[model samples]
Target: MMIILKSKKRQPHQTEKTIQILKDKLRERKIKSKIIVLENIEVFLNEKRVVMKINNWIPSKRSPVYFRIAERYKNASYIFSKYLEMKKVPFIDNYHTFTRERNKLIQMFLLAIKGISIPKTYYSPAYDSRKIRNAARFLKFPVVIKLTEKERGEGVFLAKNAVEIKRILGKNKGQEIILQEYLDNDFDYRILVLGHKTKLGETRTRTNKREFRNNACVGAVEEFFPAEEVPSDMKKISEQSSRIMNIQVCGVDIIRSRKGKIYVIEVNFSPGFTLDEKMDELNQTADYLKKWHEKKY
Candidate 1:
């Protein structure tokens, strides 16, 4: 698997055009290749072999893996490259260039750069409490504080104002935190995408009105439906976002603000599945996996 990557500052339209140009170039190429999105690639360490799945298709480590990763995603690429080396898998880019950069921040930055609407977020690596609090104040009241690595809404906190930010920050000192502008929405949609199509959709809502997170871990429930039932715009955005992230399978979490502006909240790399019953979803997933497995094998 060979990866090549690029970027420049331009207007949103220009950026869109550049992406299209890339797609065209990809189609015109004669050699076998694939677009490697950082989020789309899953590498597992706990397994017997260092299992690496790129959009469900396992690539042989014996094949040369090149790096054309973007500036924001280079750190993550470095990480993957290091793991490949540790496993004695062949790949370009070694530990000579490596840093444990924050992945969440880079993921969001990539989405935003691609013109996907996301909440205004601030990042601060500062050790001072006041510096962090000041960054939260820039986003106004009712901000969301998220610990970069924590998932399932565990490290997510809602801060109503500066005081709340202080209180939240005090409790989680030394944690990597990101301050985000809170979009007031009772519920959010999680559209599951595989390839260019959205396989399924669900609306996640908190059981209690006071809770800010719509995570199932937080006593929240999801109402699953077919892909056709999902809003067209939502599905398109989810597919587009997934494609941009180069993730073959992903859950795109989105929200509509009070003003009716749609925003992509998060694109889960390893999204969970919780259905009241398994019928179509199970079959769909099984078939999808089988198709890829057969094609790859």
Candidate 2:
């Protein structure tokens, strides 16, 4: 089996560790796989040649790319989708699906249209004070300002009002942003759904007062929940969200408010399982990928 990792040329320590662990697990499973650690394989894609070195076997095939994003996801799936279409190759999380899932604004739009209960949100390309002022007036107070196309909560902010937004936007200019209604929840849960199976669902809570964000990267504590503990409607919503977004593997962020109401926060197309604190997540993800490859090729 040929596997590729679209990661940074200079990866972070966590990223490197995750890749190492995945490779180790695959080896233990006796799965023949290759990790192509490069992002823009445009030359390889165009020439239809990826010289993969797996063990002593230098198998060469003009096989089309059947993969997901490894680096910045902007236009990642879009470009790959074009290649898939040209080669008539079946792949998971194509461009259209990736684009929609990557952008919080797009996910909100689709979910809202489907009558899903997502927090009220607003997105605007203009970061000028006037627009920020208008957005504050339109959206709920203590809303979130997010960079439209970034991951790991890299560009997310909790804005108290137009004043805070102006201060932040003034320092950084000419960047597209999204203002979302903040549902005041103490902790957030990231639910993983792969193909037709729910691999794992866990809650991430901020362990320190300094870190307000509950993302696992921000030193949040992760704890697993039993399948029976998963809210029934949430299960249905998560499943529908994946199918509607046309992704084989997905991550959905659901907010459980202080008052015990659940709101679908966002959907992730190329959701990452490699760096999960729990190794089971990584192993199961790798195993699922093995199963998928077995079925596909």
Candidate 3:
């Protein structure tokens, strides 16, 4: 069986033409396929191998799974891909890429090496008060302390002074963290990039004055814009970052400082804007998958 492991319950009826395209393509190839929602599966990992119980049945090693799981299903994709790797099953968007995307520090380092502009960030392998404090000092009083394995915008923090930094260090003792130079910005841009093309763009702004993050999941207002409307530099940055990371479809978050300097915040491996109305992003991904399946099989 060929499994299309997706994030949504089902593609919407009217606007989901792209999904139908995928279905048609699969049918043409006589590939026995089914779409399974990622959230609906139960994965169990043990000493030697990994297993997944989907509804009342299980897919054997012979079944090839393509991960249509993106955006909010980051953790789920990671776990499932790990299971697939263990079982020596072929899958799209494998475990290594997802594993690397989980670490903010690593992402920043890779982007930086590729000449992508990012905020000055530092990390420590182990918990050390002096090391963390020194990093804060270098970044100045207003520093952003981000959990190395970031969880959306939830793990990001804003520390105004040394006292606050000290408090945060104590609170998250032994936790892998990274310190970044804080950049004051009204809002940040979430630009969706796919197949080296800019597709959808949106600016996220915090509605709550106290909140520093501009995440839609955290009650921030998102004003979306089409590809043409996105700034040229941002578009270039998003494309370059996507190419560097080898993520065909991903969200590249870019923030502009008060002085109008733009910096790449982070790259979201499993970005959620594929089903959007304007761009046929999902269709493009599915097309890629069809070709990949053909080549592999």
Best candidate, lDDT: 3
Quick one: ranking by TM-score, best first? 1, 2, 3
Error of 2 at 233 (Å): 1.9
Q: Can you write out model 3's per-residue Cα lDDT over 60-149, one digit (the tens) per residue? A: 688888776555556556655655665678877654345545467556656765668888765544434565555665567688888776
Consecutive 10-residue window with the lowest summed lDDT within model 2: 43-52
Count of steric clashes across candidates, in order = 2, 2, 1
Model 1 lDDT per residue over 12-126, tens place: 7765566556656766784345555454444322112334455455555555565544554454465456555655667655642455343565556556556677787665432
How many clashing residue pairs, candidate 2? 2
Against the correct fold, how does model 3 do in TM-score? 0.60
Two-way TM-score contest, 1 vs 2, winner: 1
Candidate 1 stretches greater than 4 Å from native = 1-102, 127-130
Clashing residue pairs for model 2: 6-70, 77-95
Q: State in Å the error of residue 242, model 3.
A: 0.9
For each candidate in the order shown, give its overall lDDT on alpha carbons: 0.67, 0.62, 0.71
Candidate 3 Cα errors over 4 Å, as ranges: 1-102, 273-297
Per-prediction TM-score, please? 0.64, 0.62, 0.60
What is residue 156's positional error in candidate 2, in angstroms? 0.8
**lDDT of candidate 3 vs native?**
0.71
- TM-score head-to-head 1 vs 3, winner: 1
lDDT of 2 by residue, 1-297 (tens): 645435444667887787678768878998766665333232111011212122233323433333434434344345345435544555445543445344665566556556677776654333445555555665658877777667886888887877787877776665556676777767898778778556678888888886667887777788877546777867877777777666778888888878876788778886655454566567767888999999999
Can you rank all candidates by lDDT, best first?
3, 1, 2
